[model samples]
Target: MQTKLTRFSFIAAACLILAGCGFALRGDSSIDAKLQPIYVASDRESQELSSSLKRQFAINDVAVSKRRKEAKLIVIVKLLDEEKRSVALDREARDAEYALFESASIELQSPDGTNLRGPHTLQQRRLIVNDPDNPVGEETESTIVRAEMREQLSIRLARQVEFWSHQLQDQP
Candidate 1:
């Protein structure tokens, strides 16, 4: 019984220490009220990116307006470039590794021509190993990596918005 009590007390103390240090698990990020009702815009080539951004906003309990006119802020996202190139060659002179890069441009503005966040580039890169014996597997792995990069870029964009929102709240 004494050992059990000691163990419980230790666990409780550890929890308190972690909480005091500002350590937190990632979850919904709060946005300022001034940036509410945001609209995400994307061209046909960037539809996937827009969809992922919308998902991030939804997770944060933000409502995305269907009409641009109804939004207090507009977030425009465009795919700028994508490239896949061999980075390594095997002993047999075949491809051994590939570097994948993707970049997108983001801009935040109000409907009345106020720039909240200037145009900036968000980029993501991933290095993937290629299996010369399995061509199909290599292709599938590359595809999966690309998808993950897109999701990562979306998360970054969401964080940018959160930062802008907090900045607005701090301003006079």
Candidate 2:
């Protein structure tokens, strides 16, 4: 019985490792994956952008350390707006459903920092925080929105990566 249990445990561990448990996980080993240790500009929005990019591309997708000379790409995202608008307004400008709009200009570059993909501004809009400040169900909604934005950003970044990757591949 112990032997059977031990064998099952081994199999389970193997499966988990093969599944990429708790390690760098990229959608694929694309050019973006090869360009590890990328640099992201310092800021909250940039942080989110970096985190999201890492998720889609690879862990440590956007390196924050300046001393890290190995970093090839430097991505800068400038926040344009973080506004709240009334969706369903009352007689006055009070007590109404609100919407949040966020806009940023995203730029990706080569190792020398030449423009590879954007400066193609992307905008993300969503509804206001409905759940006061409890921070419970807040995650569910925020996660959904973040996931959506991440998908959009990934598609754009992937296209850029593919373009550069193809260029390099065609060189020789």
Q: Backbone clashes per model, in order?
A: 0, 1
- TM-scores for candidates 1 onward, in order: 0.85, 0.51
Off by over 4 Å in 1: 1-24
Worst 10 residues of 1 by lDDT: 26-35
Poorest lDDT segment (10 consecutive residues) of candidate 2: 59-68
- The CA lDDT at 95 in model 1 is 88
For candidate 2, the per-residue lDDT at 144 reads 70
Task: State the lDDT at 116 in candidate 1.
Answer: 85
- Which pairs in model 1 have colliding backbones? none
Candidate maximizing lDDT: 1
For each of the candidates, the C-alpha root-mean-square deviation to the true structure, in angstroms, is 4.1, 8.1
lDDT of model 1 at position 56: 92
Candidate 1, residues 1-172: lDDT per residue as tens digits?
Answer: 9999999999999999999999988766688766789999999999999999999999888888998999988999998999998999999988899899999999888887588886989899999888999999988998899899999899898988888778778889
